[model samples]
Target: MQQFYDFKINKIKNLSSEEKILRKKNLELFYLNGFPSKKDEDWKFTDLNFILGQNFTNIVNTELIPDEKPFNPINEFEHNFIYLVNGKLISKNFDHEEKDKILISNFDYKNEIILYRENTLNFLNNALAKDGFSLEISKNYKFKKPLVIYNYFSNSLKETIVNNKNLIILNENSELTLINFVDNNSKENFIINTIDDIKLKKNSSLKSIFINNSKNNAYFYKYLKNDLEKNSNLENYILSSGLKLNKFDIEVNHNAEYSSSNIFSALNLSNYEHQEIKTLINHNTPNCQSYQKIKNVLNNESKGVFQGKIFVKNIAQKTDAYQLSRALILDDKAEFNAKPELEIYADDVKCSHGSTSGSIDLESIHYLKSRGIPEKEAYQMLINGFLCEVLEKLNENNLKKFLLKKLESQIHGY
Candidate 1:
């Protein structure tokens, strides 16, 4: 393990003595476990240690100095934008929003606290993370347009690991729509470990969308922790399809009554690509609801996995939770795994989970072909319809159209 990776706390700039000590301690702890493998229950389906060892012979952490690059804004719809180069905030524009209603700055590394001791990735992030952003929306304010975070990586990043942590807070009665757009075109094989902490205050609402612009050779892992207060609502839409390797570990805690959350994901894995989405939703209060729907289309020996669990507390009466995973395996070598669980202590709660995976329906494809559609076009149409169902509940028209276009491109493997 020591021969494959090299990490030093001095690489991070501007740290106090105590902070450096804490970071070194975390690094030692991470070295004890290295990368997670099948032995870990949370990572049993995906052996990250073996995967990284196969791809990278040597990995190191380095400081990234932002180089000037042409910034392209998404013209599909009106939006505020923030540009990030290798996880470092570079520039931002909020012309469509009131300046006083939004707050944006660098991540607070000084006040960091250790939250997750069980996850080795979290420990690695705490030790090596150097760049990230903190964003907050003022109380009672709603953005006039969605905010697009452009995540761009430099072309020179090869065999380097980038770790970062982010924080987002939505005050009471505030609402915001955020889009995390990955715009990396680097052909280099690198690793990215990120942790995001999000808090939604009373009556606040947040809609988050994740998408990739093109295919790349990056390995990505993100752990997101969400806290929901009374009457708050959170909706997550994930359409990440172009990465070589990826995993998303999401944890949502319904801290107060009447809170609700929805997780919808649509993934198209081609060739040897692998992706997984793991979620744990905790209903700590009464009358909280959660819904999750995961859809995957695998082709040419690709792999996909979904592990979702819902927990209800003893006092969480009337908790309603539902989760379903469906996969369309287009090739004999393709694979899909699903593990759905429910741990309920409240007798008055309602929860159900199900998973289904199978090959594409030949009868439907033939029917489309007979209706004058070309065979290739028939297959594409069926796939588009199969994965687009997850986006049906999105009310934004232009955003939905943009996402649909991206999803189509990924399905065609362009």
Candidate 2:
């Protein structure tokens, strides 16, 4: 590990044009702020050993493009499909008529970028990104089709780098659904860094689902920055099933009054795997509401981590905030960690945070066994019931059903 760190330090001087510039910036920021360690209050639960011990080789392999279309599985997508192989979008699927709401360009790498200034992970993405999709939704434009983007990693020989950029602008009183799918069928090791910038206009509603079903050896680094305008609504969900290492960073800025935000996540971890999710909600205006619920099921020595924070500024009075993290350990060796926090500067507000971790319900399992059901089957039923509480809140019925099916597959595989 010591030698690997030294090698990374020495190789900094030999990077290519784009990589050298990014490396210099990343090294400076990483040195000044340092990696978010377990000792750090915000990262106390997530394990960083796997990421810190190895120095990944950054590859600029343009030949790593995926020829297969990402939307081939969906025959009737009601929305548009913007496909990305590695990081670049497929040129054949580009549409010019949607320019107002969707734009594809090399994201400007300016130092004055608002979202990446103080964020360590965001800094890494900006400095080391290869290519990405740029999506913008128009104000007051209603679309019938959903916007789906498949991020495919298909290289085996070298460790690839993918940095995706998404810009979503929702005009006042508009609505849309977005699906961000990360699918990897490769047998190689790689890294993915993506940034989503969302700006919600007044009275707009946006629903998004993030699917991580890589089913391969990969690392995921994702960050989301959302700014809510007055009287807008934003709903977001995350589903995790694969990958060896995954890290998610979310920042929601309530800039206007009467805006509401909801964040929901479901994770299933098995074998020797690790997953971490970190969220931050900042209330800069008055009368905004935020709700966050994260649920996990861990077995076979896998680990799950959840760290969330809600911040209420001095001017943000009458803010409503709620956060909950719950985990069910199927085995004695399985692990789960939760850190729920709240910072209130306002005089009048309602805020609550709760966390619970335990095994299957013994009483329920006993009752089921008494009814002629096997012990294992009874326990699986109990586990499914406990997880459904969060899934019920999902607004999309199809998505909810999809989540349940995945959950079943994960538990049965264990």
**TM-score of each model, paired residue for residue:** 0.98, 0.86
Best by lDDT: 1
lDDT string for model 1 (1-414, tens) is 446888889988889999889899999999898999989999988999988988998898867676769877899999999888888898999999999988999888887564567489999998988879999999999999999999999888899999988999999999999999998888999999999899999999999999987899999999999999999999999999989999999999999999999999999999789999999999999999999999999999889999999999999999999999999999999999999989999999899998999988999999999999999999899999999999999999999999999999999876
- Highest TM-score, which number? 1
Clashes per candidate, residues 3 or more apart or on different chains: 0, 5
The whole-model lDDT of each prediction reads: 0.93, 0.72
Model 1 lDDT, residue 238, Cα: 94
> For candidate 2, lDDT tens digit of each residue in 1-414?
332221132322234575566556765775455446666565667645336446354433233445655345444334466777776666534242355655545444443243475455566555555456555556776655566666666665246555566667787887777777777777676667788788899998888888765566787777888999999998888776677778788889999999999998877788766898889999999999999999888888888988889999999999999999999998888888887889999999988999999887788888999999999899778767766666676655665676577667655652
Could you tell me how far off, in angstroms, the CA of residue 171 lies in candidate 2 after the best superposition? 2.3
Clashes of 1: 0
